[model samples]
Target: MTFRLTFCSLIALAAASPALAEPVFNRIASFATLDNMAGDEDRTRATSAEIMTATPDGKRLIYSDSPLGAIGLIDIADPRAPKPLGNIAMDGEPTTTVVLGDTAFVGVNTSESYAKPSGVLRSVDLAGGQVVANCDLGGQPDSVALSPKGDMIAVAIENERDEEVNDGAIPQLPAGFVLRLPVKDGQVDCAGKQVIELTGLAGIAPDDPEPEYVDFNAQGDLVVTMQENNHIVVIGADGAVASHFSAGSVDLDGIDTDKDGKLDFTGSLKAVPREPDTVAWLDNDHFATANEGDWQGGSRGFTIWNRDGSVVHESGPAFEHALVRIGHYPEGRSGKKGAEPEAVKYAEFDGARLLFVGSERGSAIGVYDVADPSAPVLRQILPSGIGPEGLVAIPGRNLFASANETDLGEDGGARAHVMIYERAEGTPAYPTIASQDLLGWGALSGLTLDPADSSVLFAVSDSAYKNQPAIYRIQAGSPATITDKIVISKDGKPAETIDLEGIAADGKGGFWLASEGNPEKEIPHQILHVDGKGAVQQQVALPEDLTAGSTRFGLEGIAMAGDGMLWMAVQREWKDDPKGQTKLLSFDPATGEWSGVRYPLESGEGWVGLSELAIHDERLYLIERDNLIGPAAKLKQVTSVALQGLKPAPLGGALPLVEKRVERDLIPDLQQWNGYVQDKVEGMAIAPDGTVWTVTDNDGVDDASGETFLWSFTLGTQTAAK
Candidate 1:
């Protein structure tokens, strides 16, 4: 079962597959880490799934939950519907786990402080959830790997340094090393322990070698990454250092280098250190490193190297740029590690050698074809849960899983999740919308169909990019493509102090935009008209009486009604409105008059509000959702109000209430990708063919998974407005 690739054979395979359909991976299910908690435990408590391994039968998944001080188990009998198997308390922080037969070997760090590092290698029986054996390792462990023969285990003792001590500079006491143990009869042989010193191997800190990740090849050779030291070491099967070398550096160009809330990929860096994090063997002779720089450098990509430490190929910034095209670039991390490729795994499925690279910050996984290691081709980018930290492939079942370590449940955000994917003969289901070119775009808050073209639509961003407000033109198709960008400009410069939340085509090569405003910030709630060239033509502020009762949640969506009146959906109730009711304000540009009607909202567990508005066939459609994500999400739906009998009341008075009808429940639509339900259903548009399209904002990749979903469907028997 050994997989090997040569330069000539890889090139031949690349040119061999045009007639047959290639297998693609699509997410099938997601298991939240909190689900393993008992009924008596607080559900809001944070939990995580950091590193994971599957049983030899591939029927269950075991992951390290450091926050919970346990290893959680999952029953994957039905890979598409994973079930929780509860958690096994390890009495200490479990760092990594590897399974052989029905036993899981986990590295548990019991270190009280960085100065005194201590850990134990615990072997737990998966069937009974009991610790069967334990062996003292005499150091804090980070990574645990089982040999391909299942007879030996290797652990990386990462006696990590405290960042508060001298700003985390290395050369701290208690240098780390590698430990190897033999396994006999499905149990660790405690008496057969070997320690291999890794000190004096890295240029950055020769005395303190913090081993981050370890992996064993088929020949029982182990490859270890010293992340903080920016070095790599290979240990032979005989428990000795075979070879070691510096992980080296890379020069990056055309990258976003600032943390200024805008995505501008025009910066460059010289001689950036490729402080590799995770290394996985592509074959017996080649390996890949995830260059997630922890100290002085992070090249923001992955690299392939020969077993002798020579560079086989360098991805440079191509991997990060690929994420930019799909709207997953984390602008907030531009000044640090862009996407932060932190996890790498290599596997052969049905003769196709594949490499999986996980981005911790961007929350996505890049799938590469490594049949040709020197020129690996990116197959697809799969959306993982926030902060994917571990990846494991089960080629026996055509499945793969990622353990996301970030848990923000205490802050009312998404919890850590273990996402499962299956390989089959089908096209990729992600990246439903992407830029036609390498365009950095996100935070799509509003959408409007073009007046003259059914296949063309427009979208606008909110305050995510404060200084670079933009409108994007999209060509509607199976996977929608962003074709062009129009930066909203005023006085020959990009407009500032504007939070564009909605857009509507103005019929005459122009558009009207709804700008949500915060009074505290002095950004007025107003509407602006922009020409085809995106130059501001006019601005209209809300009446004084309306502004007097305005809150921060104002003017979310805008639409042009059939009667030549502009309609807007106020996100939440204002000071003068009744509870559970928001305003559907209207403006008559012909007479410069303002009026409004109230829109009823559904009561839910969290605050509910309107996010988008659209008009079709004399009906005003609205996107209504609650401010909850993951399993707590509810009330994401599309509702419509008939405008035929609608009447508006004068401002600063009792507004008329409009009756609404539920058209669709978007929760199921959001669940089609099998990830968590996104919170913001911010954009919607109706095409001439009666198709309804919607998009979810990614919050500009700020503390979010950075996944923007654009999908479309049609209401049965509905005709386009004539």
Candidate 2:
């Protein structure tokens, strides 16, 4: 292990973790959008919640689910316990929606092809879940916005081009326009529509004029963003063009520019276009845009612009840096758009003006105090569901919600969800563990407490960082934090090809690590002994007989017991084992002999297997969980076997089965974090005072919220309640 200490990074880490105070926003509950897939809505199929608006009374929510081609509603009367009302099929792709009174104005795209585009604006009665009226928009519509008095409805009819056709170039369309329609009784009059021409108003692709998103100011004027054209335009309420300007570029510095399994915010980029999306009006003369670059531009941040085509405030790389500091950086998109800021929401809560910025890639919402629109102060960042593509702030209920769009259910992953947060007089509870804005760490698969100091803990990274696997030292405070890093090396290079999943303290001020094997990835199940300097002291490969019929699943956890004995928890039922049983293997350094006892597995939905094991209070504790998430998650708990009657027989010949009992049901504890249940609860460590600390791996921020939850609870022997 090599310590690459840098003074600048150390200072950055110390200054980034903010201690939240009054009016803190904490996530109270999360509801899976798939729950309301009723009637023809298949439960196992994909669903999403995007572009939503809440009722004036803040009691109802309406959102466009593009994948399901429907608009879904939610009842949040209790706010903390949200219930799905139902989903109304729109017969086409519902892109966006806005609610005025109990009526929702939705934009439905029914285009057969980009060259022959067509769409309609449908007004739906919320109470009856019925489409009341349809106005042919003459083109594909994107964002739907309403005026302050709800008398005028503005829609950006973007006859969007086909990306697959000649690399998604602009000027390939029947030009788009901003359509303004008079609203009467919450219904848009199709005959009384005026299309404001938006051509020749941009520096890039001015002929194409593809309107991406639209919003209306308090003065009843429309502000539209032409994302692919890299421009912005403001049109008066009378359908006259007020002003237009290029949504210019930015010079970004100190950013991680490569997907190299490292969070190095020290790179630079110049003249990067801020092709913004999801525009929101902050005031009569000011508005904000999420720079979710589409084709030619994406500045990787958010921007505030003045109505007169001048920049107000640019959040260069601050928001992205903050995400990196919190271990939420999307390493997969480091080269494309790091933490792509895609959506913005503005609200005034009790006189405190708030701006919510959603990073689609980072999967977190940044809450900024925008009282001074020029210099918005970031107060807190709340974790949301996987991809926060849409958001709404209900000031009436002191609540904020996000519509996460990505669903990975087919792979047994987290489904799309609408998460809720409330501003209360308490601390933020989601990030049980935190890191300084400079420490790039996640996929925490292994943990071990320091023998001398429990507050000082060590953790290991899995293959998420396939290019740079290393170890981290953590300070387990009120909100546990990572303090130091040590890269395990061999031959003076990063030992990153192996997936390190289990760790144990060696009596000689070092550690013993278990590297899980994946034959597909050409990794072997091996054990290693490293000294305090991170140098490999000894290495042992699995015996040929035991490795003969091995599958991908391998050793998941390791623990040091008595004398020179080291125990390991195999992840699943490997070859030669019974259908529902896995082995707890033990190895002696003096004898180099391997013995094991069969651990009977409990049947559950999905595959039941072990994630972690720890020796505490004369008992061997195990984290047994099913490979399922969200509402499908059925098993995630801690069970233990007594050390009093433990005896390991020879591995090959009918090993004795060990008796196990439930010690803790971690489902409630995981739910206490107020998010969807993550599938990988892969690490556990015990302090000398009987405090058990556990963590879940975040898959290296890939297809995840990039949150590594680290929390502890006291464990007392308790029988299974069921």
- Best of the candidates, lDDT: 1
**Which segments of candidate 2 are over 4 A away from where they belong?**
1-20, 39-41, 717-722
TM-score of each: 0.96, 0.95
Q: Residue 425 lDDT in model 1?
A: 75
Model 2 poorest ten-residue lDDT run: 1-10
- Cα lDDT of model 2 by residue, 275-364, tens digit: 998899999999999998999778988998899989989988878877765678888888988899999999999999899999999999
Q: Return the top candidate by TM-score.
A: 1
Pairs in clash, predicted candidate 1: none
> Can you write out model 1's per-residue Cα lDDT over 457-508, one digit (the tens) per residue?
9999889888889999998854677889899999999988899999999999
Give candidate 1 regions above 4 Å deviation. Answer: 1-20, 716-722
lDDT (Cα) of model 2: 0.85
User: What clash count goes with each model?
Assistant: 0, 3
User: Could you tell me the TM-score of candidate 1?
Assistant: 0.96
